[model samples]
Target chain A: MTGRGDGIRPRPDAAAAYGAMLAEQLRQGGLAEPRVRVVVADLLDHVRTTGEDPVQAFGQPADYARAWVRPLSRWRVLGRAVATAVGAVGMFAAVTAFFRGGSWSARMSVTIGDLVVLAVFALGAGVLPWTLELWLGHRAARRVGRRPRVPDVVIRAGVMLLVLGLLFTVFTAFDPEVWEPVVLGPPRPVVFVVGMVVAAVLSMVRQPRSPALPRLPGTPERWWERTPGRPGRRRR
Target chain B: MIVAVVVAREDRESQWLKGVLDLAVLAALVREGSAYGYGLLRSLAEAGLTGLKGGTLYPLLGRLEDDGLVRSEWVTGSSGPPRRYFFVTAAGRAELEAGRAGWGAFAARMSTALEG
Candidate 1:
């Protein structure tokens, strides 16, 4: 079978190809459709049986049924708003603590610089994986059986980066002077802007596909359930 | 069964498995003299060491042939199919010999250590 360049291009096997594409789109669209949900479930079942990448055959689903849908409760929105307000106030307090000096201009510069550095750390750590994990988690969860476990590697790496990002942000916020080399150095604003542009470009590029899980010689025999020839036969 | 499940996602252990490919494939040929893809696959399955996937096996066999450890010939079988049968080369025999010595030493040491 011939492969196309991008976007799940149609193949000679039009029917199967179309079905896979449509099923994927439906999966992304909240996975609300029972039939499409079954298709996603079946795709996962095949992965469990054949030990292949389910999305390798298609692509990321459109609606991402396995993704954590935001809770519909009004309480969730209210709670989030309250927490965000608290965070905003804490951030103001942090900035207030940093700039207890006489000169207004100098304090503004330091505060703005601190905010930029904080933004870098959060983007590098939080925002990047927060966006990525939604899709990654959904894919990992749907790769197996009815009860999906978090893909350990993705979970571990994401959490590690987030924690490190938090530490970096906290450190940079408290000690804005540490970033003085870049902030006060020549072509200051140019450096920050260039860095942001480079980061945006890098994030846009598709992450490299990880190597396939190693396939052992005799594993498939154990993966599938065995059915007896006679219905009532005693078998372990 | 328990070990297989536990080690399923251990990538380091899987890389180590790659190091054993030549030995495993060579051992299969030593037992059968020569065999085709499905034949070797079945032999491995019967040996209760199964997890090999398609994306891995075919390319590995190609690499082995390229390295001259094993040579392949296309022949029509009684099953009405053209199959590529692989036979171990002299180099393969040498590699197997070295592996045997290493494995023997490792097994002996482990046995002694474990018993103690």
Candidate 2:
């Protein structure tokens, strides 16, 4: 058989390759092992019985995995949107306080330059966490052979520290007097801590009690079926 | 031109199949009483759901289990590796009935619109 084949060779273990790809995709999607095993076993059985190339039969591993993880992905997107909104509000409040020369009063005014600075702070605060997450997730996914779910606490903490540092550097350079009072003010620090605690409590209370699945819009109430995995099906 | 038309039709059919896959899987379980993952896939194929694949069906099955519509258990036999056999719950049967009725109604409406 080898001699007859000459340059031609038998295909590599398509079944194992398919299983590996599917497992990796499922892992990246943050699906537990038992769930991954169930799907992988089914695919292996299909390959053994029909001798069909899984890639040809099932299209791409990534596409299939995306379908499976649609709900989780949606939840993650929703979480990120909420986080971004909160970050914007927090940045605005902090910058405004600093501009008011550390007075936590309602009468403080924001000039155009102050607004510009606020915008810069917002961009840094918002974009740094997201960028860091993407980079970290990519690295984790590659390292673990599947995407690892970085906890919300870790990402949020990193972003908060980085943004605070950025604000300190910028404010100290531009307006030392304003920056000094803001950084050293007892009321501002107390308020920040209290606000964070309240926000955390509210988040815990508002977190959905149901399974972490996000319902696809327009799907029937009890459908429970995943959205089809076309290229543009993602809401993001 | 002919190829394009064929491809378009296939895409449409595939989309329709995906929408109805849950109903089909439930119906299959109801008919067969119980089946393993591969068994269910084969049955669906034999029943003319050619587009059904393990990737799609298994996830749907998992969701069904999550919803308490189906129950599964790992059984070990003398010959091969243990397989998890799935059985439709009573709730699943009720859901299947409702889904069938809804699908029938939708199909009728579509047919009427297309014909008229």
Candidate 3:
């Protein structure tokens, strides 16, 4: 099928592996799903038509993805943190409700210790993307004839996990009298849905590029009239 | 020694192509009106980037797509699965024009120096 390698066909497994990894890497890089779909389709078509083994054509999926899309964009990181916070609150509610025999939808109390725990969870969620990227980077690098220091990242991740564990223990161990807020937060379901919605909205929001001047490349950052509906840019 | 020679040649070709591969892909799209991913690579190969692989080329296509330079759509013909065909946008044409001028000046200077 290809000019150089006529009549060759790609192994189905290789094509599948390449396509899946490319899609994942692209998604993690913060390209929206539809864009990711189209980009992946284009690459797969190239492989099918050219009859090139996916590996022969693409060195490593993560490396190829990094070349195309900058991973761990700010918007994606925010979305992740919000999603994790929502999950943590839901789990905490479920456990408490099970123990106290209370309705799952009951309103939650806002203790300072709870806030501390929530913040710790959200912070952990925020760093999750970077952690995943490091793992992917190490694997991709090793496969592609490059050696990255994997143990250092492993050590760092272990330390972070231990720190998170210590924080969780300390916060939960504090007595209820220490810092319970007087006000009760919203009911569980509403808060959970709202948090999820906020996370969804965050993922969709584009981080604004540095405002390009009307004239050219280099200019001071100036706030111009922003276009409606698009939250990212302030271009005239 | 043989593996080293091959790796060196590969690196040299990619390094030289790095600056212009995206531009060349853009030029091919502008010239052809529209083409699929593999078809575009074939055109590049015919234009002397014969060793260009899909791995290198797709990322360039992706960057072009992201920059609003080229737009793509899926088309299904009588056979095979649907393929994405890319068309150069108006902005892409403007960028290509600017690139053409830049390349011409740079190539002329390099040519003069190499022959001198």
Candidate 4:
């Protein structure tokens, strides 16, 4: 990946990049998308108009967002992490059931390889991205004099892809195709039912509360599904 | 060295604004009747709240609007993207007055204490 030197001028998209970064942080913090859009627009309007470097203006996007969005407690983060993990596992089981096409009582055709794949998929899809984002974003918020470079972002993304690719490649090389497929037999009803129930409960009960959107003009109140009488976490 | 100093100064200014920003913002809206974001920044800077970032101000405006203290709408600009202009609601004006009086008394007390 390469970076443009502002066409020998300077990186012109810094403000935009910062806005995108901040918007992502806010969304991850449970802010609604429309509210995020409005926030980003307001940020860009001022920065673009003034020709201000966003880092200089806001220190770090992540830091500013953390302060502005009200940091979630550690338990809340843990709950979200749990939800993502359980959801991924449940999804894998559902997909397996779909492909195998049998009654719920049928001994599921799951391999040790399938289990490996599921673990890798769960860690990759459910665990890694947001965990890294939260950790790195939190740390970066503390350091100043950071510059937004397209190449830097591209490289980080590429490294992440490489890691995931490497994991899949390793899992495939041991691809039970070469050996007697290690068979984990009979999907027991108790474990299966419990897993499904836990997943269902977590999915329903542990949803990251959608931050309430401030009543923006031209938008109707009927559109948002706030709980009856309890306004969602006041749009911090 | 120079950049560090500038950054440090800006940090100090922003820290000062941190506590009083929402109040200042509310006061600004009431005083101007209405203003867009950039216009608000300009007004605040002129009033000695320099080095305040858009990151700091915009979110507070949003929170204020969210809380029903101020309201905003997108208006077409002569150039560039449309701007969202904000106005203090009656509630917002009322909030500004109460906050203003409270802040004034606090500041006076601080000044007296500092002189001692």
Better of 1 and 3 by lDDT: 3
Error of 3 at A205 (Å): 12
Model 3 chain B: lowest-lDDT 10 consecutive positions = B57-66
> Which numbered prediction scores highest in TM-score against the true structure?
4
Stronger candidate by DockQ (1 vs 2): 2
Ranking by TM-score: 4, 3, 2, 1
Tens-digit lDDT track of model 4 for A129-170: 456656655544444355444334675698689887898688
The Cα local distance difference test for each model comes to: 0.47, 0.59, 0.64, 0.65
Q: State model 2's lDDT.
A: 0.59
Off by over 4 Å in 3: A1-7, A73-86, A102-236, B1-13, B90-98
Evaluate residue A135 in candidate 4 and report its C-alpha lDDT on the 0 to 100 scale: 61
Quote model 3's TM-score: 0.60
Which of the two, 1 or 4, has more lDDT?
4
* Model 2 residue A162 distance off true place after TM-score fit, in angstroms: 26
lDDT of 3 by residue, A1-236 (tens): 22333558978666766666676566555554445556567667777777877767877776666765675656656665565555545555455434544576787666676666666665555455345544554365336434555655676688778987897787678776776664557676665555555555434333322111122112232443222132111111
CAPRI-style quality class for the chain A–B interface of candidate 2 = incorrect
Winner of 1 and 2 under TM-score = 2
Residue-pair clashes, model 4: 1
Of 3 and 4, the candidate ahead on DockQ is 4
Q: Order of all candidates by lDDT, from best down to worst? A: 4, 3, 2, 1
